[model samples]
Target: MTRCRAWLYTIICFALAGLVTGCWDGVELQRRAVVLMMAIDPAPDHPDWVVVSVQIARPQRAQPPSTGGSGSTSGGNKEDRPIAVVSREGRDVAEALQTIQLAINRVLFFGHLQALVIHEQVARRGLAAVLNPVAQSRVVRRQIWMFVSRERAEQVVNALPVLDVIPGMHFTNLFRNQIILRRQYDATIGGFRQRLVTPGVEPYLLGIDGMDPRLSAPRIVGLAVFADDRLVGWLPGDDYVGWALADSQFPRLDLTIPCPHGHGQFVVNVTRVRSRLRVMNPDAPRPKAVLHVHVHGMIEGGPCVQKEREADIQVLSRQVQQVLAKIIGQSIQKAQHLGTDVFGIGRQVYRMHPSAWHGDAAWRQTFPRLRVIVQVTTRLDYMQTYRQSALLYVDHEG
Candidate 1:
């Protein structure tokens, strides 16, 4: 009985201690600040000075002490709260950020940041200075999306969207959708850094600019190509489509194949795409790359020609394959001639033959002289709608 009573007493004492001190690390929501986006641009007066723009979430409008009626709407007043662009002049990015601290009320928090928008002028100068903070911060995740804006980062971030109140949130979702659906190249900061570190692989970032918000259209205007840590050039608009198709990372793509025999056009959305690259060295000859692409897709739309005939399907498939082969081959040639390794062919070669990597010259020296061959094969599956016959007859002459 004495032992049982001592055990009960110990349990009661522990329960009381737990109730007294439960959570010491907890923080009130009002004490914390959230950042939406950040932008870096060049200062006009001082050529080396940097301008920093930070978008912070505003607190909900407080209610009156008596009635307790809130002033904010159910959806939150995201648009009314204009992001304050605080411009500071300093010799370097670190000093600029420190200087801004004096002008702002809350601490500059970066946990919830969506993107880091850098201006065109700044990108040309180089990103090593400004990017130092992001790379060093333990709180900042490496996957944060980065972009080069043609307009001033301030204007790009402040542009109000007609559909969504907060432009930053909308822009983040838009770019993310491009990767989820495989519409454009994957340009995450982490992946980009890896490519930059890897020998012979050039990194690329997409250029983002706002269109007329009334029409709800946002577009990728161009691409910002990088050689290691510096920006080299920009590839304009759909021209990057070829680069994307050539890259093994962006294999699945949508293409509209036009019929040469006046049968109109067919929209083909590739489902599974695989590319095999081989590097052959024949007795001191310059290394040659041969690429083989195998794909399967469904016919989105086209005029039915010999719809049920197996021979016709085979002919059409072969023709489509030929067209794809030509387009892809052209893209590869363009990248090689431009001296860009967007396809990572050099990296493949390094993996295949480690000895060749150490002995051969730099990728740029060999890229201009490298030769490439492309072969493609496409298989078409069942039509989107099954009601139609393989061959359709307009009129039967009996």
Candidate 2:
């Protein structure tokens, strides 16, 4: 009978322990400030100090509607604004974050951080100091999108989103669309981290600029090139598209080439672009790198040359190949002139010929002098819905 009583007591103790431990350390959702994005800028007053702006989602409060003879309703009315921007300054990013936490009643949570924006000044000065803390943080995720703002990072973060209820999500959707459209490079904290440590590759981020003085919205403008951690320069406008082609990230591109008949320009919609890089004479003092790009495309709104003959297609294809080669060559020259290896050609050499790569310094010295060749082949497979140009049909009928 004593043994049975002891067993019952043990069972009760186990149940009590389980009940006591459940949610013992979990904080209530209301007590947490969910951070959606963070922006880092160099403090204007003090050069050494950094300004950190955090965008937190504020929970909406619903008010009950009031019903009366006057027909006034108050229920379900609430402020639609979803985010609050807060800023703090300190000697470093961590200290700035600590100061920000002191101002908020709830604990700041970074697990939901969607974007990280660095001001142009901060990036120009160097990102190592600002990014080091984020890299070390346990709550921050590496997959968050990273962008360099042409204006103050705070302004970019605080801008009201036109499409998304949350400002951070606006930036997220922009990047998503950019990837789908193949308009710019898709940069993330994880990708940056990998490139930063890689021996031969340099890091780059998508550049974003405010549309107006008030920063009603932010738009991606170009690519920011980084040597080590410092912003070296930018690849603006169509120049970045060429870089994208070399990087093999270009999904589709539209180009205008001179018509074979020399009357006007025609549109070529390039798709299925494939790029390959080859390094030759790895042991040589000056090595050669060749980039070969194969593109399959169709003529979408172009005048027909040579009565739609097969020779006309070859001529058009050759013209497209020449244009692509020129663009890719120009991009490579620009990178070489800037002394930045945005193409990761050095990385290719390092992978193919590890013994040739002495160090970063050596690679940098050899990169500018390395000979690069760009070869582009374009195949015109499909013409538009009409077998011949509409103009041609009219001319034949006439």
Candidate 3:
């Protein structure tokens, strides 16, 4: 799978290299506006109209060294900005995009597009109007990241970031780091499309809100759940982390556990994971599923675990295991309540028990009532070398 993906990316890069290097027809490269990011929202007034926005890479002119004489500052700070944002509304997504192209001077080029942001409300309405075009169009790469915005997506595409000067750079960077550092994956348009069409599984998108005025990469709110193409519900904030732990493979996550005895908390960076989710007794009525996760982690912080003893380490591992189990349980309960199978449990059921597993509608009813059991085991590593917390001088309680 890994090699196939690598080859697939290589072929795409090789194929699209020409689009970026040269001009389109007779138009100069400088005259074309490279759209770095795009956002879609339901029209403010029109019940069925769509609002689309694009962030174009601002072209900078060569500036001569100021000999303290030339004061050609007509454009003010606008010339120094890295991107430009344009928005327009139309009856549909493709129409809105065409209207935006007419509104801007330069031809709108989407070959270089990096990210797509869809307002949560618009997502709930349905994404076929948006995603259908994206799928058939040869220009936009299916690898672009997709986000469901908690706030108006226009703000996400317009606001510049302090660190990433370029719009959507933060998310692109985070996507790379998520795979490399965290050993996890974020939703890509290609993956989402597959999920959308494949039965027995539902699609989910990473959630964001560009609440910050300065436009740091959008804040991660949670996950936007979907039943087919329309959004069903959300898993607000850290509530999604539990789902992440169960669904993703071998992710290096920082989990904070309360001090076993006292008033402080400790953080553990878990890695080197051995995990799997199995459909136990798929033939039985109301089939049972077991999620077994084993992770080895090292103490990363806090005043707990000051000493390196076998007994103490064992107890600490148990505590971490309990917390992980609780989190997994909560995530499972939330997913079941929403009646959207984000965990791919239904897919597994179909694979194992094809006869018993019916179509999506039948599985949907069974999923909510399905019995799921979570088992987590944690092992603490580097206990001997872990840094001991500083001793605080506590006066005798009066």
Each candidate structure's count of clashing pairs: 4, 5, 0
CA RMSD for every model? 8.7, 8.3, 10.9
lDDT of 2 by residue, 74-167 (tens): 2322354567789999999999999999999999988889989998888888887788878787878878888898888888777654444666
In model 1, which runs have C-alpha deviations exceeding 4 angstroms?
Answer: 1-33, 61-79, 82-84, 180-186, 210-212, 215-218, 236-238, 250-252, 282-285, 303-308, 359-361, 384-398
Give the CA lDDT, 0 to 100, for residue 86 in model 1: 58
TM-score of 2: 0.83
The sequence of per-residue lDDT tens digits that candidate 1 reaches over residues 96-159 is 7778777776677677777788887887787766788776776676777788887777766655
Instruction: Kindly list the per-residue Cα lDDT of model 3 for residues 73-111, writing each as its tens digit.
Output: 232365666777889998888898888888878887778
What are the lDDT figures for the candidates, one per model? 0.64, 0.75, 0.74
lDDT of 1 at 56: 64
Structure candidate 1, residue pairs in collision: 307-390, 307-391, 308-390, 308-391
The candidate that achieves the highest TM-score relative to the unseen native structure:
2
Q: Against the hidden true structure, what lDDT does model 3 obtain?
A: 0.74
- Candidate 3's TM-score: 0.82
Worst window of 10 by summed lDDT in candidate 1: 389-398
Q: Candidates' TM-scores?
A: 0.77, 0.83, 0.82
The local lDDT score (0 to 100) that residue 241 gets in candidate 3 is 71
